[model samples]
Target: MRLVPLDIDRDLGLVHAWVTHPRSHFWGMQDAGPDRVRAEYRRIAENPHHHAWLGLDDDGTPLFLAETYDPAHSELAAHYPVRPGDLGMHVLVAPPTTPRSGVTSAVMRTVLDFCFADPRVERVVVEPDVRNAAIARKNAEAGFVEERQIELHDKVARLSFCTRGAYEMSTPHLSPAAIEHAHRRLIAKALAEFSHERLIEPVPDGDGYRFGELTFRARRFPLEHWVVDPHSLRGPLDALGFIAGLRETLGIPEKLLGTYLEEISATLAGAAWKHHHRRETAEELVHADFQAIEAAMTEGHPGFVANNGRIGFGLRDHEAYAPEAGRPVRLRWVAIRKSESLFVSARPEEDHYRDELGDETLDRFERKLRSEGLDPGDYRYLPVHPWQWEHKIAVTFAPDVARRAIVPLDAGLDRYRAQQSIRTFFNVDRPDRDYVKTAIAVQNMGFLRGLSPRYMRATPPINEWVAELVSGDDELRACGFGVLRERAAIGYTGDAYHRTGTSSAYTKMLAALWRESPVPMLAAGERLSTMASLLHRDRWGDALVTALIKASGQTPAGWVAAYLRAYLRPVVHCLLAHDLAFMPHGENLILVLENHVPRRVFMKDIGEEVAVMNDRPLPPAVARIRIDVTDEIKELALFTDVFDGFLRHLAGILDVDGVLPADEFWGLVRDCVRGHAADHPALAGRLDLFRPTFRHSCLNRLQLRDTLQMVDLTDQAGSLIFAGTLDNPIAS
Candidate 1:
């Protein structure tokens, strides 16, 4: 698309049309009429630091609207850190089509080309509304990274930045010359239809100059003897006569109409009502005259007046008058001298009147002005307060406080349950069933460890049941099984802990089963081997045989190898004998510990098992295996599962309850885990190995540090050392 300067006359209408287009609402232009549109373009056309243009597609159709602001010259200068050669920019796709496919990125590239082409320009910044994810994504693709999310101009805007270096690095192939050419083309088109004129006289009160009948001034200007009558000729005398006729015809109501006419005459040399063929045509002629006058006055012709249907100029150096009681004074007759000047303050009283004008009329008037090629920002007639107008461009960056509708977790759980039921009933005898079951179990363990902590303190009730069953206590087992059976029968699995088969579920269930299963002192015994084999055929026999030898406290010797060979498949035996058998249990132990431990595991329950292993005189290899497995599981329970789970739970609780101190809960978990691990040397080693992994995982999951506090675990090993703890305290 071609990028060219905006032409106040020719391109004003198009710019206005784009701005008033419903899509442009986000860009901050309300509906405005042609006259205001022209006024806005006039303002921008005269600005040296701000540049705008219409971008065209290859087919020569207008594709997007692009604009750049030198932050040093704009209000954003005060808020954003401005670089001497930096520019702030924005791009919007026109309607009946929004940005399609890569259009936004294309437009952004074009804008970047224009901005960065100037060797002096060092960076470009964008502040898109955080909720405008599409724009944010497009910005990222255009090589902008989020610097921070900040409140700018009363809106929550995501402030993103692209430095020249980063942009060059990310988009080396983009052509700066091509972007400049497009910008030049757009600017040239916008300037082509612009009207320039000389002032007739010096305006009063050092307000600049007067062009035609309109006087230009800072912030405001006065409306001259301008008449919009359907029945008068174009001369001053006729205009005066038209005014007299209007006073008589409208009956002036004797009270309100006289003051209005007197005020009009005082501002204008003479009052007149002239007849044009149509009301709209006459209004345009009056507005055009005002525009001509404004252009003549400003030093750079950087101003224009908008009449739209209103017939008065804004009073210079005078606050808008608040009449005690009467027909409302017509501010529409007021004209803004500088397109960039802030409008009259929209005080409470004025707002009542502005609102009464109705959104439709205001929208139409705004659209008409924009259609005539004006930035909505240039018009002073909009009802928005002066403060609101000053930050108009940045307003789009504001945060949308409207809460989005979120599907609660309960609903997600229900949907997961339904899907799980369908999968179970249909795929019961599928060849991958065991694999799927193992996968499901692993996923359940993860969820129990991850999600359940957020819902309840201690182990969630459901996890407690699972722990009871795996710990092999008859009363607890029966009770847990009864609950499970009841839940299954009712088709109400509480929260679908076993249903959806997510990664979290797998991790949680696997961890819980490993830690609590009563088959061996450590989960990696013959029973676990059998179970693993039933679940996964590829790794079954070897896994079983290895677990048996480990549990029996025997080293893999001649007989053990033969037994393994007899039980496992030939390929499995060969692979295990060669590759797997020599691998350390520490790594495997860590993996199993991560998969099986729930958020909370009772230390006393596992202490008895560790004691049994310590008393046995197994082979050095087998003894090491037991020590590593026990240590890893216990350490994971204390460090990773408990610590991380507590933090996640605290965050969830704070979000729901609104007043809980997360630090207190985190401290409690840390203290409990620290004490438990320190008291057990096997657990201490596990904790140390698991600490780094847990920290890394937590960092990845929680994007913000304020969401979860990190405990000081650096001195933990030193504390354990002071206590004279060793890897295997029982051996000493």
Candidate 2:
């Protein structure tokens, strides 16, 4: 398909036919005569800010009508903020003479691409009638975010926007240049992480260090962190070749080497795709919305080398569900026999499905159940990842389906976007709705990304307990620290799998939970951002944190201090004062921002990640979160998970970007921890945030040792694979 300028003289009749058709009532030109339509087109032609286009098929046949205008100069300027690069767009597919499957969606994408064809355009805006649900879905599929309903001159319109980055993300492809670029960066990361884990010790060469045939200059940080310069590296650009060359040195098991390499390949491909399609610069992302920043992040986990190894996802699945893809998805629903399923919630009185699915959807689901000769009250609704339903549940649980223990239902109406944590989803259709995290039996990082049915029962209770702790504590509440509680959970068990009594992926397949959204917590003028974006860098190696600091209008040190207080202080307080430690990684936290500076943080992934280090008395329902570990091991939660896993990467970004030196960054963190210690002197010396040295808990080591199920969640302390100790960067 292609776009050409709409000629008023030649295309007037065709355009009039499309706008006057009964299906085109939303176009608002249904009553206009041919002369009136011609006059409208003539007016649009005369207006410099507005232009029209006719989408043509291969044979030069017009299939759709498209229009572009400058929102800054159009009627939309009064409704919303019109940035310099924002361009308005409108599309109407000629009511198809012969029905086509995806013609409208394709036309919408083409018009968006046409608008963005001009390098000056960074965002595309749309204003469809609020009642135009068909156009609303089409707009969402094209990555447009509906801001709000506005009373336009013509009608009540749903004002929406799509950024270039989000559009490209929704439609991604691989490029040879991007592949080579990503390989070099991934190889550099592998070398640095492998060296840090003591898998391969690079010996000093002339100006840099050499490992096997690879050579690079790197700055060694306090925790033996290697900051390798991607450009300065002298090595083969082949990631697989580099890994194969040092297979013996890295000590990857002979049997698992190929599997590990496959993961490496997938990671390389994902990174390359991100590099190729991602168009947002650090400066532009500084002012972006929460999901925009999320979709713009290039790197996955900072410490892990094979972080994006989504093994089961095909190319189409990647486009449909990958977090970086920014594609909206509807979750597949199923009805499980209530006797065989478990539904638990923090608030039993609240009908979660009714709130999430709405009354019409609930009625439709009940009707489906009743149509199957089943009683609606006999079954419970459970949402599953579409991929999982097609790939795993349909085939593996066929027996249960035949026996009427499980009945497949239709997909939900709400559109959700995949979160950075692959299993979790954000409700893009309705921001205030709870986040639905589903089980997708795809191997990523070190485990099949599935929700354990056993854990599902305790999820809501554990989250309730943690939320209470955070809210009741002054230190946590003072900094606006909060947890997005998993308020409800549903797990469906196939009798066949249940009889086996194994904790494998099969047992974990069909479970989902609802976590409270951070959107409802925002006050006026406040925005949300993923904490991971703080460490994100653009293609030009500009750090997002640096852009944020510049935009905040605060001194570098002052900005760093503010971030530490909002994020670091609460983490330390939780550990030192409450003897509770969390996985507080960047992806697990959301930052509340005001004027581009972090004002507070909200922690998620609660039930599976939170651990009580001491032998604290707990309710039985919330007891699963308690992990018995020594004081030394407890300290690793900060040193290893926080400082080494996360801050090390952020420090490297700021240092490389020349925004803040690593020393000064860690010093601010030290001050944040010390100030909290001063507040509670009785807990001051229990766990040392500032110590001379601490154990280096190796993350890559865990993945390398076992590519599947690396850490047993129940025995988290015993499952750790640690190397020798390293100097603490925060220690005086």
Candidate 3:
């Protein structure tokens, strides 16, 4: 494949077709009309930081659309440290006319070669939706290493990168010259057309430009006219005048001039294109300059506050300080402090002590201070009341001692006590187990301050409960029972709790209560199911499914089974209705205690469900309602978001396998699609949904064609048969 710079004028129809195709829903452009497409292309053509190309096979067939943006020129620069030569690239394959093996590899190789052609470009980066294993694997085959995953646009993306060396070494067969030649052709075509158009009415004012009506304002500098086609001689004008006069100085041949004007006819036909160009340009400017603009805030400040890091300052109000003891004393200095605290520790020193003291003596003094009801850990020492000073003096023992204290003596003891109490209440002794249970409980049950007494009377020791939860091998029945009992006692019935404002707060209380309870209570099965169901409903349907899978593995079998029987229908219905995708592995299922229940009934494995979707046609009834291919793709994208969120939540509760088993999860997903395709023909040609795997890269074009053909036949048969049985079938 070769990288050909996209000629908006020549490629508009093709680009529009690709974007609005049935499989393009994930990009959220399936419903876009010609007007929107034209507008989008116009904006793309004008953006300097971003370069779009049509990936063409050797036969000159367009294989994909490759768009590359320098992170330094994208909004991501604000969050990531961008190297001058780092380029962020994205490849969106055009839905193949036929399944062609190795096409993805070919396309990627071409894109990489183009990106690395510039010696200035040292690395190429991409962030693909984490669920798109096909793309992820293809990236791996193309020499990209999986970096840390990042959340972008509320979805997790596998951020992968390829250094110039890696790209060059990985694909020995790639021809850089071929890709460059193709790109130059496309770019030259665009430049020639652009130059010719400017020659006539060469100077564009707001009213005369294509899509000008849609623009917020006319182009400010009209820099293209001056630089692309310069006619010298009369050159003493200022920047603006020189720019405006370029049109008169430059002349285009008449034959080529007509071609340029004709190329923009499609764009000029739509008002959306007019507005799109200006908005796109504005977006580009904002994205490119965001980091610089943000940095400007610290221009006169003491030091730069990195993104998400803290800034500290002090405001001294000397007027508020009072020397009198009976009256309230206010300190003049008000300090504002901030820190990332990610790795830093805050250590307080008692160096100014009442007298000379060694480290051991200081430790003893600190213990003594604790015994005397003074918190040595206190950091904020502003005295708010006169009584606070009295408490401070009592702790210090003498005026001389108080005067020699390094930390402030006027701080409020009551404030410190209250702060410590609050902190203690939130801290989980068994963080892994208690934290998950509490978060789940809170998500399902509203927090009530009054519940503290009930918890104190009935909850088991927090450490024991946490140990049991994290053991990871606990039977689903037992885990479910425990979750149910705790939630039921706290009046948390499920999604109902999430509706309450006190959900998060209540969860914290539940954790504390669980740790302190004297006896462990195993909840009834129904209660566990209800709570699990409620948690699932709080977000996207797939999210709920993933959560339930996790909950099933961690909770007792009886509780999980009972919960599944009671709540599975709602969860399943939601998943089907929303077209949610998830990994249905065996571990994801919690086996119910009932002997009559099917083994699959309490299925804990997310991998299983993912496999079911492969080559699988949506049940006829479901397919009728979800036949809009674009909508299905969009739903898949949403599923990716939901899956990521579920994993994040699970990370707090489960071990490594629970947090991210990327390969296993993606494998199940691929199986599901493949299996589903076996029975459905309509899904046969849709490569847009399933990205090619790394191993699939070795398949010859003919083999790929045959495989896709068989899958399509299967999909068609399943979908058609199902539709035939339906009373009413929707048309594609």
Any idea how many clashes model 1 has?
A: 81
Q: Per-residue lDDT for 1-732 in model 2, tens only?
A: 689989989988899999999999999999999999999989999999999888996347899988999898989888887899999888889987853334575577668767888999999999999989988977776788988899999899998989998887663335567887888899889989998999988899998999877788888875788888887778678998888777777778888888889889999988876775576788878878898789888888898998899999986687678988776789999989888988998565227778988889889989998898899889888888999999998998888988889999999998888999888999988999999999999989988998877778999999999999999998889989999999998888756777788777788888999999999999998999999998898887888999999999998889888888898889988988788888899999999999988999999999899988777799999888887778898889889988998888888778777888888888888888888888889988987777799988888888888888789888988988878888998896
What is the per-residue lDDT of model 3 for residues 346-428, given as tens digits with 9 covering 90 to 100?
11223322112335544654665566565655421111122222332234223323333323322211111110001111111
Count of residue pairs whose backbone atoms collide, per candidate: 81, 0, 72
Clashing pairs in 2: none
Name the regions of candidate 3 deviating beyond 4 angstroms.
171-732
Question: Cα lDDT of model 3 overall?
Answer: 0.34
lDDT, each prediction: 0.32, 0.86, 0.34
Off by over 4 Å in 2: 1-172
Give the candidate number with the greatest TM-score: 2
Clashes of 3: 72
Q: Candidate 1's residue-wise lDDT over 195-239, tens digit each? A: 111111223434233323323332110111111111111122222
Q: When superposed on Cα atoms, how far off is each prediction in RMSD?
A: 37.9, 12.4, 30.2
Instruction: List the candidates ranked by lDDT, beginning with the highest.
Output: 2, 3, 1
